[model samples]
Structure formats: C-alpha cells, structure tokens
Target: MARPRAFDEGEVLDAALRCFWTRGYEATSVRDLASSMGLTGASLYNAFGDKRALYEKVLERYASHSMAERIRRLEAPDIAPRDAISSFFRETLERALDDPEMKGCFVVNAAVEMGPHDPELRAAALASLGEVEAFLTRRIEAGRADGTIQNRETAQELARMLLGVHLGLRVLARLRPGRELLEGVVKPALAALDPHVPG
Candidate 1:
C-alpha cells in the first residue's frame, strides 16, 4: 500500500492562501507556493495537483475562512441591520489598516488581476460577491421592514450599491492604507443609508 501524506492539508492550504494573497496568482510561482507551504514541488503537485488547482482551493478556503466572519456578522439575527452593515465595513477597514502590506482583499484583487481572462476565477469571484450581496440584501430588506433603514431603494439595489462601495474601499486601501482615508470613504456611504440623517 502507498504511504500516507505527512503534512497537514489544512495547514498547507492556509499557507498557500497567504502566499497567493500577498503575491497574487500570476506573480506567485509554483516554487513560491512549495517553499511557503514547506513542501517539495513534487509533494505540492502530488497533493494539490497543480498551481492553479491550489489557487482554486485557496479561493474557496478564503471564502470560508477569511470571509466567513463578515458574513456571520451580517447574518446575525439579533444585530440591527444598519449596525451590521456599518460594522462590517468598519471591520474591513480596520483589518486593512492593520495589514502591513495593505494587500487589500484577496478576492477583489483576484477579480481585478485575473477576472477578465479566466472564466473560472471570474465565476468564483462572482460567487463570492453573490454571497455577500445576498447577506446584504437580506439585511437591507429586514431593516426596511423594521423601519430602521430609510427604505429609499429596493433591497437588491441597495445591496449592489453597498457591495460596490465595499469593493471600492478595498481598492482604495491598496493605494492609501490609512484608517482616516478608509473611514472617510465609508462614513458617507453608510450615512446615506440613515433615514434620520438627510442625504
């Protein structure tokens, strides 16, 4: 019988995710992944299939791992809709400010870097965005029903707008990476959603 693999698959995927997150898909060579994951090139191939395959797993892992917390916060039953939306953006900005490389979001970066050329990545990116948009749409609909949100726009419309803002913030973070700058960008966007505060 063949011997079992020695390394932890989860650990290897996490390391690969970080490598791709930092260096990007095109820039990160197979050797880079192998080194980062502390595995030989042959081992990486044997385990993950190929560099592209590893990246696909990394994207899935990122959706489940890095993006899960935000989705959880947005989906919390007890949290107010406006607060949930605000806190989500605030947390994203906070994390971006704390990041030394200011790499922004991995999904957003991947969307820009590989989206046009790669159908698979584009679909994955869209699926990831759809998850967030769905959560936002639900939250916005709930807020409208409760009269906490302004209810000026349809939930779907508002969700798309907020999603755009979130994506923009991520892009801006890559260039500015300042708390104040990110806050400046997010505050007005959130403020516009407030019924009490005149637009």
Candidate 2:
C-alpha cells in the first residue's frame, strides 16, 4: 500500500492560498508553496498535482466557499435585503479598507494579474463578479419595492454601478487610503440611488 501523506490537505491548501495571494501564479514557485506548507516540492506535486492544478484548486476552494457562499447567505430568508447588502459590504470592502495587510481579494487579484493572459482564469473572475452584481440587482429590486431604493435608475444599471464601485473600492484599498476618504466614496455612490439625491 502507498504511504499516507505527511501533511493535512486542507492545511496545505490554506498555505497555498496564502502563497497565491501574496505571489501571483506565475511568480510563486513550487519551492515557495512547499516552504509555506512545510512540505517538499515532490510532496506538493503528489498531493495537488502541478502548479496550474494547484492554482485551480485554490481558486475552487476560495470561490466555492468564500465568494459564492457570501452571496448565498445574503439571499437567505431571515435577512432583510438591504440590510444583507450592508452586512455583505461591511464584511468585504470595509474590512478590506481597515485590514492591515489589505489583501484586496484573491479573485480580484487574479483578475487583474492573470486574467488577460488566461481565458479560463478570466472567465472564473468574471463569474464571481457577476454573482456580486446579481446579488446587488436582487437587493436593489427589493429596495425599490420596500422604498429603501428609488426606481429612477434601472436595477440592472444600478447594480452594475454598485459592482463597479466594489471593484474600484477593492483596488482603492490596496493603496491604503484613509478610512474617512474611503468611506466618503460609498456615501456618494449610495446617494446616486436616492431619488432626491442629484446625479
């Protein structure tokens, strides 16, 4: 029988995720991953296949849980839609803005760095962003019904605008902008959805 692996797969993947987060796919070496996980390159290949395969696993791990699940949780029965959105952004951008490391986003980072060159990676990135946009669209539609959001802007347009703000905010926080200035960006963007607020 084959010898059992020395390290935990989940732990190794977690380390690999951090490695990919810190160093873009092309830049991160197998040695880097093994070092991060306290394993050898041979072991990493045995456990997770080649670098490309490992990166794909990392993407799946992140998307399946972190990205997709957040949108799903917001759509849950108990949470108010607008309140859900507030909580979602409270967790995503607000935390990104305040985080000392300011890890913008794994998917966003992959999008900016590897997306243009890799169609598969680009598609994955677009899908995750689309999920966020769709979530906002649903909430905006709900807001229209509840009167939390005005009906002036089409839900599709407003959702796209908000998604753009999120992407921009992620990139913005990478520069470590002051919390006040960063928070200022949201009020104006949210104001645009208000019927009384000027365009």
Candidate 3:
C-alpha cells in the first residue's frame, strides 16, 4: 500500500501563500517556495504540480479568506449600507497601514504581473473583483430604498465607481502607507455617496 504524506497540507499551503504574496509569481522561484513551504523540490512538484499551479491555489486561498469574506460582510442585512461601506474602507485602511511591507492585494498583484496571457489567473482575478462590485451594487440598492445613499448614479454605476476607488486605494496604500494619505483618498470617495455631503 502507498504511504500517506507526512506534512500538514494546510500548513504547507499557508507557507506557500506567504511566499507567493511576498515575492510574487514571477520573482518567486520554486526553490523559494519549497524552502518557505518546508518541502523538497520534488515534494513540492509532486504535491502542488508546479509553481504556477501552486500560485493559482494560493490566490484562491487569499480570495476565500480575505477578499470574498469582506464582500460577504457588505451583504449582511443588519448593517446600514452606507455604514457598511464606510466601515469597509476604514477596515481596509487600517489593515493597509498596519502592514509594514505594504504588500497590497495578492490577487491584484497577480492580475497585473500575469497580464492577459494567463487566462486562468485573469479570470480568477476578475471573478473576485466582480463579486465585490456586485455586492456593492446590492448594498447601494438597499441604501437607495432606505435613503442612506444619496448618489445620483444607478446602483450599478455607483458600484463600479466604488470598486475603482477601492482598487486605487489599494495601489496608493502600497505606494504611501500613511494614514493621512490613505484617509485623504477615501474621504471624498465616500462623500460622493453621502446625501448630506455635496459631491
């Protein structure tokens, strides 16, 4: 009978995720992944297929635990839509500021680095981004009904705009990891949706 592998798979994947997150797909060699993941080169290939395959898994892991979860919270019925958006941005800013290296979103990094050539990575990135946009659209519609959001645009348009703003904020956080700078970027973006505040 074939023997089962010894190492904890989840632990190894977590280690690989961190390595890919830090170095990115292009710069991170399989050797780096193997070392960080506590596996031999042969073992890494045997388990995860290859570096690209491992990175795809890591990106999905990040999406599930981070990006998708945040979007899921935005859809919660208890919170006011406007407040949910505000809280989301505040949380995002805090997390970005807290990161010493300011690594930004791994999925965003992968999408850019991989470009259009990698259909799988591109599709994964777009699907995650679209989920957040769709969630925002739903929340905006709720806000309209309850009179929380006073924006003139349709929920779909507003959601797209917010998605763009959020992505821009993520990029800025990597470039300038200061609270003031990040806050300055988000304040007006949120105000654009505030009925009490003029655009």
Best model per lDDT: 1
Candidate 2 lDDT by residue in tens digits, 112-139:
9879898988888888888899899998
| Window of ten residues with lowest summed lDDT in model 2 | 190-199
**Is 1 or 3 the stronger prediction by lDDT?**
1
RMSD from true fold, candidate 1: 1.3
Per-prediction TM-score: 0.95, 0.90, 0.94
Q: Residue by residue across 18-90, what tens digits does model 1's lDDT show?
A: 8999999989999999999999999999998998888888988888777876788567788898888888898
* Per-residue lDDT over 55-96 for candidate 3, one digit per residue giving the tens place of the 0 to 100 score: 888888889988889878766878888888888889888989
* Weakest 10 consecutive residues of candidate 1 by summed lDDT: 190-199
Top candidate (TM-score): 1
What ordering of candidates by TM-score runs from best to worst? 1, 3, 2
Q: What's the distance in Å from true for residue 119, model 2? A: 0.6
